[model samples]
Target: MKDSFYKYFNCNNKEELYLKLKQNSIDTHKLGKYLKFNQEKENKKIVIRGQNKLFDYLKNNIPDRDEVQIIMFNSNMEVLSDNKFPINTQFKDILDKSYVETANHVILLSHENEYNKLLRLEMDFKLFGYKIIDRIELDKNLELDSKNGIGNCQFTEEDIINGKNKNFKEEKKKINSKELHEFMDYYAKNELLGLNIKDDRKKIKEILKIANQEKSQEYFGLITYNKDQNITNIETSLFKGGIREAKIDPIIITPFLLHQDTDGLIIFHNHPSGSISPSQGDIQVTETIEKMAMRFYKNVEDHFIIGKNKTFSFREEFLLSNYSYERSSNKELSISEKEINLKEPVKNKIKSKEITKEKSTRNRLRSRGQER
Candidate 1:
């Protein structure tokens, strides 16, 4: 049976036995459990036998850290320590008084003949709520093996020494307006938006594309900037269309901007059916947002209304001059004639009213002729 078993497993020697056990998904922790069960069944101790390759592997990988606590158990199942406990001390006594609770990792080193003792100690530590992170068994010549008793306790040499893999590198990609334009064009076709801009110009271009999409409704795109005008975060929202109105509260975004230490913000919204002109509501909302931002020491960089392949900039067309003129002289708010005429909705409404009045006059004349 033994010959058949060894032949079937292709394990010729103790080294091969250890390798087969490791390769068969029987890790050190599971092996420890199996050994404990056998010991209890036979009412006798079972020792772990292995080669020194496992120990050498562990020594090469395990980082030397002050936070790691090493405990050595002798063949007699006694704890041996020069710093904390004396030689031939009882394992339970030393363990009960040890400072293993404060350690990040606990390494157990013992002889191959002491496997049963080591397994019992591991079980005890687990029952006592202490994690035995690493365990190694030594051969007859007191040499360490390459196999670790606990499977998940191993760490890579690079991870331990340098905190991360030395060969891993992250590519830093640059954002440009051309890339943004392409991305916007693609997403607009899908009736969706992707807010992943890391550049200011990229963010502005994306918002413009979203606003100018042919079948799109009103969408609000907010771009937050740092003190150096670098884009920090971008967000967007969809709103009901046809009414040509959307409501946004500056307070909803103020907390996040404050947390990010934002220095400025740029807002853009679409007017699906009208010209790229700022109405009275647009001006009022911009002023309200500006006031709120000022209270938090933030700046409103620009508010843009995108319409039918064109865009209106409030700062360039109105706010900058309005603020300067207001500071110079206190006066009622006034809008330029060009701005009013540029508003397509206002012109359409006026034309509709004139047509209605002309129809009413013609109908009254026809009614008088019929009565005569």
Candidate 2:
């Protein structure tokens, strides 16, 4: 029968066998799965030299006898079959025939020395329209060492022994918080010039500390926001020591805003003297950004001043209301406004906290009417 099988295919190598199977319309990978299912239902045993947890699991789970045929391979190229072939049968000698011609499933039990050879053999078996149920690795003593398979068929010795099937949904919920912290720490150290904190307020405070550590000078930061209100990107502009003022040019940042397709922006600069007050220059720059953003149908959401230990939000202080239609005008705005506008009560509360401190720095930046 084996001789007849060999003559039918007339193949010289594994690749030729694969092509032959393909031409014959045999879905080898699928056939492998089907054979595995049949083997499980029948509880067929294709034992190696020694027993282990994986063997025990298989013995307990599979049925006593079934129509499915299982083939086991060892380092010596020994073949355990219903019809006895020679004891030292070379794999190449059997390659001329298709595994599917003789068996329903192929279960390779490989020792450490035989693993690579068995892997190649398994690949050939798969190509020749054979369903491979298990490709298990055994130690030198032939005990259960590792279980390997592709896709859903993959399992571990522990999983089989404990009868534990994988739960993909629950597995996904396991967040690697350590990875997140590491990434943030690296970004704060290497990417930014200022301090890094997880909390927004603490982050601003740390930035203030770093900016004023040795000498006090203004540092400007631009935060770009997407339509979803998430801070998508951040950039900084540094000034010389003892320079209390910095200018922000919309033209310089226009390309970036357009590239990011930013829907809103927050422009912040630190006060080296720890003054939590927006200067006239700061207000003027905010208005300028607001005007330019309106032209592109974008928003100047907030302008923040990071001071000694405190931070001031131009939006929270109602200084930005005039540039936002949803805040200043009573009429209904678009869905985009719904995303950018703060609630009326929140605006009122912010307006109640009157601006108590201010600084004088002049720049002729005017505001255009807020676009709906």
Candidate 3:
């Protein structure tokens, strides 16, 4: 009653077949190894198709490290797509072209000279992607005369961390008289000692004093306390040039009256050139002052050799004074003091460093280690 014949269907499964053809002609079964589409449609030319949106999903969600592949199946479970074009081929371009996929970030590797140009470009691209730029290293490969050149590379992360840029204006705020005195003290202690001052110690001192006096007309003073704060003591050193009516830097010749309890001292003078050196006459005047200071109970501590950064200070070294003073013999002085029953002198205590909790915390958290 029936002839042996192959059957072909236009639909892939019973659901599609029933919906499209109004009939389910074959039993549905899950083949273990392959999806075998058994049909007698060799002459009828039936076709099966998958959703194109499946490719869009794969392109958008592929993992960073994995590759994607396309699969094809025939009626008898044969692979129909050509294997030559691997599914992973040009997958990167596909993802790159997709608006849904994006890179995590980008890095800039150009030199300082190119930084501005690159920065502009980077800003433009930042709307669509992420990026990081390197800071210029100023110590090397920096060109002179360029504001944005690598010359600025000397700045450190500490400079940024400390908010140097933000605090610049405040750091240079107007200074007070008390601060000026303390700064002078520190400067004298550190910059006016030893061999550096031995030759011109007296002269340097006189000059500094002139620079500090209220009557000084030409000299403007700048001194720093501790390390961060600055103080200025304004004075006129002299009238500029040979104009007789123009007052000249009157050489400061103040007597040393500081007590033994004084911590430090610095004296400076102004040269019309702003030079901080002693003239031959200045030297003689300084020597005379030194002799007078020793006569009293005072110390001629430090002399600054000022000239911008060309400045020098003898306090960094030790120097023996050349002058000899005639005084009462030590035995005679001792005998005179021994004869009197003297009441004990009250001791004055001075706390030089004020250690605040903020300072302690800052010290503890500083990137550097404590000094040995």
Q: Residues 1-372, candidate 3: write the lDDT tens digits.
A: 221111123334333423432232332121100111111111232222322332222222221112222222344323232111222345244324322222333222222334454455346435555332222112223211222232222233342233212221122123233333333333333332232333654444433442232122233232211111111222222223231112323233331123323212234444444444344333443345445455553334444444421344433322213332222231212212322222111000101122354477788777465553
Would you list the clashing residue pairs of candidate 2? Answer: 32-131, 42-63, 43-62, 43-63, 274-308
> Residue-wise lDDT of candidate 2 within 205-249, one digit each (tens)?
343333332224666767665655555666655332345777665
Local accuracy of candidate 1 as per-residue lDDT tens digits, 1-372 = 112222323434335544555455433333334323322332232222232432333443332232222443334323332122332346677566564324333456544555666566667667766555455654544344423433323344453453221210111012233332333433333322323323445345533544244334666666676655665665555333454777776668667556645766777787877566665667667778777665555667778777654566765563522221122233334457565445444545545766787899999999999999
Worst 10 residues of 2 by lDDT: 357-366
Q: After superposition, how far is residue 115 of candidate 1 from its true place, in Å?
A: 99
Consecutive 10-residue window with the lowest summed lDDT within model 3: 343-352
**What would you estimate as the lDDT of candidate 1?**
0.49
Off-target runs (Cα >4 Å) in candidate 3 are 1-275, 291-302, 306-321, 326-372
Q: After superposition, how far is residue 224 of candidate 1 from its true place, in Å?
A: 0.3
